[model samples]
Target: MKLISWNVNGLRAVVKKDFVKTFEELDADIFSIQETKLQEGQIDLDLSGYHQYFFYAKRKGYSGTAVFTKEEPLNVHQGLGIDEFDDEGRTLTLEFKDFYLINSYTPNSQQKLKRLDYRMRYDDALREYMQKLSVDKPVILCGDLNVAHEEIDIKNDKTNHKNPGFSDEERAKFTELLNSGFIDTFRTLHPDDVKYSWWSYRFNARKNNAGWRIDYFVLSDNGKKMLKAADIHTDIYGSDHCPIELDLDI
Candidate 1:
């Protein structure tokens, strides 16, 4: 099965700019989106033959996630079940017969690390939640994790250090998560590939190929055998983030 994950930045906005065409072209078995940035009834998308699931933030025009799957899942879940994090509508989980797929939009620490404390707390809670789910079944976690995990993952690592998405704390959290039993599929599959999934809108970042590989498909360690192909679709455009894909033999 081919699964795709993208942080569309905003569903309403992207849909106006070739989102439907892009969606149809990708033709993934499961397509997961983050940062929908809308509330209920904001947009009525017509995606035939796919089951649509949307999770909205309590606040309008804010964080949200959506999932489109050709196959109907056995069950679906939203959030990590923590009041603080659940309010943001950051995660959408679908349970299949053999595994769990979680699409997430991890919180950014924000300018000057203003929200760093909250982000740390959120990461810890999310880690615990993912670990709990992994105990039940292998989990496929993907989305804009908001951290440039390694120096090779970001273009200006030296200058971006300690910034919102490149901070030491955030990187450590991601490392800990992997150590706890998740595999960074793209990096594992293409260790030397300097590809990025996200680029800044300003400073001609995309034009110059200055970007960060913040979006990812992280699989439960035991599910490594299921990973067939992983990629960062840097050529695609709509949002600042490009879609990442993970193909599974299962």
Candidate 2:
């Protein structure tokens, strides 16, 4: 089975630019996107042979997530059950026969780490939520986690260390999650390989290959056995963030 995750930045905007063609070319069994930046009825996607699920934030044109799958889910869940978090439409889960697929758009700490405390709470809640789900079934978690966990994850780690996404507090939370019986699929497979999924629009980041590996495909330790391959599809372009893929034997 093939699964793909991407932070489209803005689904509506991408739809006007190569989104349809890109989706067609991917042909994934499950395709999830984050930061859709739109409410329901804002855009129509003609994705034939796919079942679409969307979670819209109460605030229009803001944080949102969506999932498109060729196989219909046995069940669908909209959020974390926390009003503060759910109101932002940050998460969505689909229960398949063998596993639960979770797509998320983690809260950004923002400039000067203004939202750092809130983001910390979100991290803890998400970790607890995923762990609870893992108690019943394997979990495939993916999306723009919004943090570069390791120095290797960012092109200029030294310069970005104090920045929002690269702050030590955020990175530590990611480590805490990984330590709790989950595996970062791409890192587990690539080890020392250097690649990034998200790039800054400023400083010609994409052109200069200055980016951060913030997007991820994380799986429960039990589900790691099913992981065949994990990759970053940096070549595909529509948003500042590119798609990451996972191949599972299951």
Candidate 3:
């Protein structure tokens, strides 16, 4: 099955930028979107062949996530069942017969590191949530995690070291997540590939190919062997971030 994840930046904005056409062209069996920045009744997507699920943030025009799948899931859940984290509408979990698909838009640490502490707490909660899910079945997690896990993940690593997304603390949390048994599908398959999935909109970064690989598709070890292919569609032009895709033989 072909599964694709992207941080659309804003659902309404992207719709005007040919989101419908691009969505059709991608032709994924399952499509997950983060940073939708919309609320109930704000916008409607006419996805004829897919079942849509959305988790909207309590705050309007802010963080949110959605999933569109051709195959019906056995169940769908919103949030991690934690009141503190659920308010942001950052997570959507879909349980199929074989595995759980988690679509998340991880909280950014903010320019001044103001949210760094909250972000760390979020990491702890998310890890526990993921581990609990893993005990039941393999989990496929994807979205704009908002952190560059290593020097290899962002261009000009030395200059970005102290930046919110590249902070050592944030990167180490991501490392802990992977060490806990999840594998970053893209890196696992193409260990040396240096392409990135997200870019800064400033200074013509995208045009210059200066970007960060913050978005990802991480899978439990049990789901790793099923990976067929993984990719970043850098050519897509709606959001500052592009889509990351995974093709699974299962």
Per lDDT, the best of the predicted structures is 2
Error of model 3, residue 191, in angstroms:
0.9
Question: In candidate 2, which residue pairs clash?
Answer: none
State the lDDT of candidate 2 residue by residue for 11-90, as single tens digits.
99999888999999999999999999998898888999999999999999999999999999999999999999999999
lDDT of 1 by residue, 1-250 (tens): 9999999999999999999999999999999999999998889998989999999999898889999999999999988888788899998999998799998999999999999998999889888888999998899998889999999999999999899999999999999999999989999999999999899999999999999989989999878889899988888999999999999998
What tens digits encode model 3's per-residue C-alpha lDDT throughout 1-250? 9999999999999999999999999999999999999999999789999999999999999999999999999999999888778999998999998889999999999998999998998888888889989999899999999998877889889999879999989999999999998999999888888988888889999999899999999999877768899999999989999999999988
Relative to the true structure, candidate 2 has a C-alpha RMSD (angstroms) of 0.6
Score each candidate by Cα lDDT.
Answer: 0.93, 0.95, 0.93
TM-score per candidate: 0.99, 0.99, 0.98
**lDDT, candidate 1, residue 201?**
97
Name every residue pair that clashes in candidate 3: none
Candidate 3, backbone clash total: 0
Candidate 2's displacement at residue 9, Å, is 0.9
The superposed Cα distance between candidate 3 and the true structure at residue 41, in angstroms, equals 0.7
TM-score of predicted model 3? 0.98
Note each model's CA RMSD in angstroms: 0.7, 0.6, 0.8
